[model samples]
Target: MMKVMAFVGSPRKGGNTSKIVNSICTGLKENGHAVEVYYLSELDNVGCKACDSCQANKVEYCAINDKMTTLLPKIADADCIIVGTPVYMLQLSGITKNFLDRLFTFYRRSNHTARYLPGKKYMTVTCNGAPAEAFGNVTEYLNQLFNGSFKMKNVGNIITGNLTNKDDILKQQGVLEQAEELGRKLS
Candidate 1:
């Protein structure tokens, strides 16, 4: 079974984004894959400071000692990663952006290494209050961030749109099913 690190990037705990990620994890677990859901809202995460300490001394890890620092090791060991976020102002949420920023350390140190997180697979889940098509920009942003910046293989992206209320996503049977289906396929 694959070990998947699932990150819920929405600040609203158990919000629409979280539900979508949870659905994916549920399917992964059913398929016998180990899933760890990291809730950013519950952790005290400071945005990346661009200190480059991780590049200078690999042992120091990320310069900031916030919750994300603790996750570095787990992320390094995971076979796959899943990131879910709600689109804010036509972009990824602030927390998600910060998390992505922190990954720059890997980019800095592994600039010449083709195997940097080479075997790992990843997928993105994005939700928006506007039409689903509006999420294309953010979806492409994440895809390029992970696929190009990190050099990780992208499994796929799930975008749920037109969800203004908390329950809007859960009420969308197709999106939830898509999330689960995506997880199953990943497994």
Candidate 2:
């Protein structure tokens, strides 16, 4: 079974992003894949220190003595990863941005290459108050980071917009179903 790790980057527990992520996880679970979900806003993590400590140490892991010290290892080992975020101020929320910044640990500055992330599969979920097309840039940025820089393959992105409230996602049954199908088809 695939080991899937999902992160809800929205602080709202039952928000649009969380609902979409849960739908995806539900599909993966039905397929007998092992799924673990983490709420980024609730997790104890600090932004990257930029000390190059991860690249400096022989082990090549972040030196931060927080939750990520352990979580980063799990990320490296995960077969698939799902990241869901709610757009804020035309960009990723602070919580989501900070968590992604922590992923710098996977970069090996030595040879300008990345380690432990190539070939892995990743999916992104984004929710916004504007129309769906408004935040393609946010999803594009994430694609470039996970697909281009990390050499990870993107399964697909679930981009939902025109969501005024959390439960508005429930009205978008089509989007949720698409997310579920993605997880079910995930290898």
Candidate 3:
């Protein structure tokens, strides 16, 4: 079975972002893929320190001794990564940004290559109160990170707008179905 790592960047439990991620996880599990979900807001993860310790030492993992350090191995071992977040101030949530920053550990200074998790499949789920078209830049940022920097394949993405409440996404049946289909395809 493929290993899938899912990160929920919303602090609210059972929020729209969480529900969407859980739906994706359900699809992955149904397809016989192992899924692990991490709530970023609950984790004590910190941003990249820019210490360059990982690069200098040529280590495969980050040097920071935070919760992300423990998750690094899991990330490396996974076949796919699913990131779900609620838009904040026209960008990703602070915790999600920090989590992405921690991924810098995967970059190697010797050859400017991603040391681990390269070629893995990745998908993003972004929920915003504004129109989806209005936040195309946010999606582009995610694309740059997953496709460009990490050198991962873009499996798919779910960008649902006008979701201000936890249950609002439930009304968007098509989006939910799309998320499940995306997960199944990833597996």
Candidate 4:
């Protein structure tokens, strides 16, 4: 079974973003893929320091000793990475941005290549109060990061909009089902 790492970037517990992520994880588990979910809002993760330490390979990991350091190995070991976020100001949430920044360790400045992360499968789930078309650029940005910069395979993306309340997503039909289907297809 493939290992899948899922990150929830919303601060609200039981929010729309987490519901989508949890649905995807449920599908991954049903497909017999090992799945681990991390709530970025609750983690002590920090932004990239840009110290060039990981680039130089001076330390075996990111120099920052935050919670993200512990998650680095899990990220490296996973066969797929799932990122879920709530759109904020036409972009990803702050915590999600910080979490992405911390992934700099995977980039080797020496060769200008991503280390231990290339060729991995990647997916994203984004929920916004605005219409889905309003944030196509956000989705494109994520796609470019995973498929272009990181050299990862773009498996799928679930972009849902008009979800303001924590339970609004549940009221929408087929969105969560689509997320589950996306997860199952990943396997």
In candidate 2, stretches whose alpha carbon ends up further than 4 angstroms from where it belongs are: 58-60
For candidate 3, the per-residue lDDT at 78 reads 89
Model 1 over residues 1-187: C-alpha lDDT tens digits?
9989998899888789999999999889888899999887776777877666877765545878678888887788899999999998878898888787777666655454433466689989998999889878998988777887677889979988888887788679898998888888774
Under the 3 Å rule for N, CA and C atoms, how many clashes does model 1 have? 0
Clashing pairs in 2: none
**Rank by TM-score (best first):** 4, 2, 3, 1
The runs of at least 3 residues in candidate 3 whose Cα sits more than 4 Å from the true structure, single-residue gaps closed, are 58-60
- Each model's lDDT comes to 0.83, 0.90, 0.87, 0.89
Regarding TM-score, does 2 or 3 come out ahead? 2
Q: Name the TM-score of candidate 3.
A: 0.95
TM-score of 4: 0.97
Candidate 3: clashing residue pairs, number: 0
- Model 2 residue 109 lDDT? 67
Q: Give the alpha carbon lDDT tens digit for every residue of 40-84 in model 4.
A: 988877688888898888898789888899899989889999999
In every candidate, how many clashes are there? Answer: 0, 0, 0, 0
Candidate 4 Cα outliers beyond 4 Å, as residue runs: none
